[model samples]
Target chain A: MRILPRTAESGSYAALAGLAPKRRPSLTPYYFILPYLVFFVLFRLGPSLAGLGIAFTNWQAVGTPRFVGFANFEAMARDPRLGDAFQNTVFFVLLTVPTLIVLSLALALFLNQPRRGRAVGRVVVFMPYVIMSTVVGVLWTWILDKDFGLLNVYLNFFGIANVPWLVSESTAMYGIILTTVWWTVGYDMVLFLAGLQDIPHELYEAARIDGARAWGVFRFVTLPLLAPTTFLVLMLTIINSFQVFDQVYVMTSGGPGTATLTLVQYIYTTSFQFQKFGYGSAVALILFGILVIVAFFQIRGYRRGLKGVE
Target chain B: MSRTISRAAWYVLLAVVVALVLAPALWMLSTSIKPEREIITTQIRWIPQNFTVEHFQAIVQNYPMMQWLFNSLFTATAATLLVLVLDSMAGYAFARMEFRGRGLLFMIVLSMLFVPIQITVVPLFILFSRLGLTDTYWALILPVGANVTGVFLMRQFFLSIPGELEEAARVDGASAFRVFWSVVLPLARPALTAVAIITFLSTWNSFFWPLIVTRSDSVRTLPVGIAQFLSLRAGMVQGQMSIGQSMAGAVFAALPPIIIFVILQRYFIEGISRTGIKG
Candidate 1:
């Protein structure tokens, strides 16, 4: 629990670097951060680079790195599985992000009310978010069971047939989407709830004084203020939605003929399950590129919105 | 009148949302308690008619659940502790210190957050396989030790504090580490707690890393074990198991984060709120 406060008297950063005390006692910060960095480079950056290397070479995990440049990427271009994975991953992001944002904002509104049970409700809803994805998959499997699940059993009175929630390709991704929404909405709700609390009461009163209706206040006032949080959550949700490996692995295994096969899942299969390091690495790098581009567009949109505000 | 109309609509919407969210969880709980006959029944009942705890009793009595619980709890705790110490130190340096390459270094680490956790899986496997670290707790704890969020978080939090406190301490001839340990770390409680809660929860909930690393039930954590339980083709338990056992596992896995949040709900919100917005 040591902290090193480098005493830099000069205002300039360069001056601080030269003028600060030589003995940085918490130089331990470097060491403190060392373990993580070592692992990061080794596990994260190393493999990612190795993955890049492997992509260029026909390197399986067990084999020599014989160069077969551009072949893996070319194969990816032709691979129908890669194409399906891309579509499904995009579909997953599309389905989950909007629903998550909507549900989170709605719940945040509910929990924002200064009511007796509001706190309790907030904690309860947030409970699911904290659970492991593995546990979530199992719980949903039982709950969404076609013959034995609560969903179809409840639907029995309406004379609806039992839906093959995770079995059929058409419905399979939907099941994953629904499960994802339930699991992650609470996290965003908490964020939005925090954002809502930050909005001053004076704005609402001011809107009312201007003869603004509830919807008017929400549209003009609340929505504008919540944009920052919405932006952040939306960006995170898109990233997280694309990175759906654990649930797919646990629940569907990208199954029922590749309906739920996300790009990351494909990467997983190639790397670990199929043992094609080069192929997996190339797919991973592409997925990484896609995510980076998506992140850029989102931030661009956010910046554009911010510019409008300014 | 408008208030009344909107309020009614709000209630209906909230009701539907709550039902949609709670139905799966409630069903898991119900199925957990119901007998195999009741579970497989065509009729839907919210309350289990059989209401048996046999599955729970079996999970506890028949399985090595206690070990799994201990393993998950201890590993998560250890990881959180290490992260707090190291992350805070690095965070303080990145925020307060006039270190070389600090901004660029911080940017690199921050960008790495988007590196899909899956990207690291292979090299880690290769690395651990070489290190002979497989099946050990160190394997589970080390790779995830350096959390970019924690470092970024600590740095931001330190910057927010009035610098005069550190100035005052340093004037009194306090060393940097001493200043951070005694004066700064105590003040960063809210931020530290935020990092700790998320860290512990994620660590506890981690399945993929541990699944790849640990060999058997002896070293495996709760989530992986439960996943194995579901995927088990062994001894095809025809009517031998019930939903209760899985629910109990879910309850075990889910309850800790809920309780931790209950204990520190304010800090929990503060943590998430700060994560993205802060530069």
Candidate 2:
């Protein structure tokens, strides 16, 4: 991959040397970075630190904040809604990630083949991804409506009973999951297609000379070569799924007795609706902590995969 | 003969996949055109028999749907422009310049990626409210404009452009900014376009922050406005939800991004693949 050169020390010097004129020092670079850094600090870094601080204080919007010292964290621990939100988030992650990986990979492999009309197929598959999340949520909610829903209509045609997808607790999360997969699989598919394109055809030629069957070629050659892309897709999908909110908010509003209440939705309700900014910040930190830990493990696994590839 | 059969089968499978993926969008369009009575029918109609533009007219005339669309366009465009300038400058510095603490600062910026941007929302809301920026377009435009991923992407792209072009321009007595403007920026068109498309799509589609910050219809972006519309209609008397109007609103909200995707499909796909490689 092109990224292989990035780990070398000389790459940075090469890049820096490119920017220099007559081997003299220049301050223009700092000027370039300053504008972005200002906003970055004010909006990103400063707010992140403030969020951490606010998590410990009882700061409602109007009142002077008093230091509460882990009370919010304790509240998070005891709150059943938070627990439900946590479990639902985990359930959503588990439900979506593996399925997304497998399905997108399959689609990518299918489309990777040389065929007529593949361009149309690619565009068709990718179109849903560009639509806004709220639109996806609203459209899917209507399509899953028990009475007039297209899904129920199809089911009825097949002699099946009407299933209230978003209204029922058992089915609501799954509906959200299905909608998500439909919406996002195109991105991962495109990534996998790129990975497939990156693999040298010489290896496939060698396998063919050795009389390898199609399945054998895919299993032995394709899968091993695509490991890095798979890792990238897995990490991104996991991180994104853990923060699922918009669709859940629009579709179910974390409703039917909190069945689809994701951590993000929980945080929003706590901070915005209930005006418990401090407790909301605490939950947000918890979410941040969990994401960091998850990302850490994923990075560690990626390194291990790289070493194995080497 | 066997190869031909398999190719035919692939076409069939691909067709089924396309139909499944496009069904919801196609249904939304269909519903947007259908008359009110037809939309509530249990029968599945892929094509509306009684087509009418009343729903589209209704939303535009009565609701702030047009305002939401305009707000979405204005904010998304501003955010995209701001991101391109800021991220490209920062990316150039990281890619090409050596300043004091450059490496450390670069690492800090990269680490910001994992910070889970939602963590900033509570504090940002409070800060913006304090500044009296809440419920305004500035509140929607600024935070999103500060995204660091564009910086990373632009840096990656700048790295790929060989140093000789910039060096040549520099030796010709062009200032750093001048060289960047005339030489590097033109060459960086593909990357800039990618960043622009991504920023516009995200800003236009952004719901969570706008939903939190903006309380009035005057400043609400399309996604939030449409969501509020759905909730409001759903909450009213049973069966009062304006299906056609809501679908029309959704179609309006969806069209710009979808059209952009259709036009710039290559860049979209290329950009995603590039991010995977770079990440």
Q: Could you tally the backbone clashes for each prediction? A: 7, 0
Poorly placed runs, candidate 1 (over 4 Å): A1-36, B1-19, B232-244, B276-279
Q: Per model, how much of the real contact set is kept?
A: 0.44, 0.61
Write down the lDDT that model 1 would get. Answer: 0.76
DockQ top scorer: 2
CA deviation > 4 Å runs, candidate 2 = A1-25, B232-240
Position A165, candidate 2: lDDT: 85
Candidate 1 lDDT by residue in tens digits, B8-107:
7767765676677777777777777777777667777779877787777788786677788888888998999988887887787777775456688888
lDDT of 2 by residue, B120-215 (tens): 898898889889999999999999757888999999898888877776766576777888889889999989987887788778878899999998
Candidate whose lDDT is highest: 2
Best by TM-score: 2
Worst 10 residues of 1 chain B by lDDT: B231-240
Q: Could you tell me how far off, in angstroms, the CA of residue B38 lies in candidate 2 after the best superposition?
A: 1.6
